[model samples]
Target chain A: MSDSTHPDGYVLQAYHDGELNDEATARIETHCRDCVRCRNELAELQRLDGLLADIDAPELPRPVWPALNGALRKQHEARLGPAFAFSAAAVCAAGITIGILLGPVGKSDQSSTNGTTWEGPSSMWSGGASASLLEIHLSDMD
Target chain B: MTGMTDDQLMIRGAAGDEAALRTLIERWEKPVFAFLVRMLGSPEEAEDLCQDTFMRLISSSGRYRPEGRFQSWLFRIAGNLARSRLRRRKILRWLPLTSGHHETPAPGLDPLNALAAGQEQERVRAAIRQLPDRQRQALILKRYNELSYQEIAEAMGISVGSVQMLLHRAMSALKRDLSRGRHES
Candidate 1:
């Protein structure tokens, strides 16, 4: 219906799609009952929808999940691999510096002064020797 | 994991839960693939783009907000990829070597359908293909994907009013094209 009182194509489409509010829908429903033009327009829209629906997408092979997973894993590694390596390297460098600072001279000095046995970095890390080494190192700095 | 919503799955996927990602892929791959095929008019390209879409989803999952429907966000990604591929195809078509290339229909049609029905279906598909990109997208999202007008708007990054206008123009064009095809045949 192209008349001033009849719903336009946009309104008809909206009404056909159920997008109109209840009051608007009711108005259109009542109008369509007396209006052949609006009825045909609505039918045409439905028919076009049906025609499009008749064509289904061809059944292709399912996506290869394993390949996708592998790709994702590689992407993840590429993003984080360098950072992880850098962190590991930093940790190793810190450990080596600590070891050099607590070398044989530092250990012997601590042993002579505190009568606490000098232990390697391994023992220091194991909590048995760390406190005495820290005290000796602090005293040596003083 | 299967029972979880797409938003929940995306949240888990963002957190590096591979199973959640897998579930999301399994659930969405078909529909996304179908949408791509309709958009790109080639199953092979659709397959490639569909994979790309999921890859993108996982890569960008951390930034995904659960503010809208996951399906809308997902289709938006797929739609963008399809549009890019189509744009590339247009540029490539101008090349001398690729000038003669034509888009082929997706294969595997049921042979049992009557010949006339098959022809009609082809005509509709061809008519759909002839639609402008935005109109075709809006129409397909509405007709085939069954997205609401608001969802189509979100997927297309347009207002709802624009979506309605696109659909109206699309339907009018299809009716014209299909009717013209009938007369010529």
Candidate 2:
């Protein structure tokens, strides 16, 4: 295999594939004209090429677009559509969270300004002692 | 619409043109499916992957770069998807309980006449399948897809010289296998 007639089947294969430049193609053309072994090898390569090329493509199934179209449209919508929906949902959630959070802060601020006040939900403090402790802390901070 | 080039269609698709996307699918569905079917050797899987390929195209249209030929880009995506599927198949082949191997009859083949024709086709496919992955890909892109060596290089992420060498080696191996099969038969 190493000591074949042609040193490199490179040019031969290239020529067979028509990958060679015009000048190189001409050179191989001339070489192949006189060389029996190279010609035979070239023929074998061509036969292989033909066999590959002849592998038939399967008949395509009917247009798959109904599902594909739905999928693509869904994908397109997923890409373009969900983004707005996501942001809108995010904004609404943020608004609710902020309102809930700020409701406590707003009540705390109004009550805290009056000094020594416990103005949160009554459920937060279990005993009178706890309420008094919280009042003292609030008064100290104020 | 029909006269629009693929690139033009892609650009329109990128711009949110549904009609352009439809036209693009109509234009490329068969060719892409054919490429996938041959590459994967399973019509059912190929059909599924074919749809995925277009879905990917549509999804990625926003980032579409028209620097290269659209056909080459499309095949590059298909080639990548096929490679991933092959890798999955390789992993699945090892599992004991899984019936992972499915050989779809070659398209247009009638089971009655397929006895003879199918064997030959399967022989060629088997020989091709026996090739190292890159070599098989180089050969398929060049021979089956009719892509030039350069396009094959682009699609396979290799050099033109590598593409040439891969094809040469692939052909050499196929010739040996086919000749041996001929003798055996």
Candidate 3:
């Protein structure tokens, strides 16, 4: 019998896996041919590999596609929901802001006597008045 | 569709092509399903996790950089899910309410067929299940998934040397377990 320490079983796995270089493989092969213990270890490793390969994979259930599609749909909707809501809210907000700035469009025009100059209750509804008010507010913060 | 590579299909999938996503599913669901079944020991959980994995792939498509092979990335996702599920199961097992819940035999696996596989295979499966996570993963990726050491390392997020050492240790442990099982029998 040969010494087990010389060609340890750890390297045998590497050899079996074809991970070793040709020179190393040749050395192990030659040693195994003469050594009963290393040969048995090699056989054990092969047996393990065989057993694992034999373990078949089970079939996936038929509903996987529908379930996956449902999940994907939910994901897509989840992703789009907030953006859509924000956009709709933003459009509404802008419309309201502009409506407040413009102040009922032609309603104020008919009330003005000369109609040459547009005026409203606060005077901020007029374009130049609104810009000036914005400037004042911004400058005040500065 | 059949001629397209996984990455190519992934690109289409990222672009929101439903057909491309469906094709990708057809290509991958089996291997991924099998891998999960062996890892989780419960086909039901495996099936759920497998779906989750693809769902994630689609959702994160924009972020999908081909850092390595797509298969490696896929396994990485599946492996992470399996680990998380296992951890949850472990914690849940201690709770009185969940004590009875256990992994069942995979669906479609005949009881007679399973028994016909004989005692040795059962011992091998038991020993495999007993291995530490990294060891078991490395062994499975290499042996069953047919991944090279480099690919295993990529999927496992470990060094190549680590993968090599892990497999060696895993095999050593399995050998010991089998020997012990033989003695006991």
- Judged by lDDT, which candidate is best? 1
Question: How would you class the docking of model 3?
Answer: incorrect
TM-score of 2: 0.72
Clash pairs of candidate 3?
Answer: none
Against the reference, the lDDT scores of all candidates come to: 0.76, 0.72, 0.72
Off by over 4 Å in 1: A1-3, A80-142, B91-113
Model 2 residue runs over 4 Å out of place are A1-7, A76-142, B91-117
TM-score of predicted structure 1 = 0.75
lDDT string for model 2 (A25-119, tens) is 88777777888988899989888877766556665677866787656444543444444455545766996787788987666556544654434
Model 1, residue A33: C-alpha shift (Å)? 1.1
Off by over 4 Å in 3: A1-5, A85-142, B91-118
Instruction: Sort the candidates on lDDT, descending order.
Output: 1, 2, 3
By TM-score: ranked, best first = 1, 2, 3
Output the number of the TM-score-best candidate: 1
DockQ scores for all the models shown?
0.20, 0.18, 0.19
Clashing residue pairs in candidate 1 are none
For model 3, how does the per-residue alpha-carbon lDDT over B1-185 read when each residue is reduced to its tens digit?
97988888888878877778788888889878877776777777888899999888877877888554888888989888988887878833221111112234446768776564545556777787888777877887888788888788889898887888899999889878988987987
* DockQ score for candidate 1: 0.20
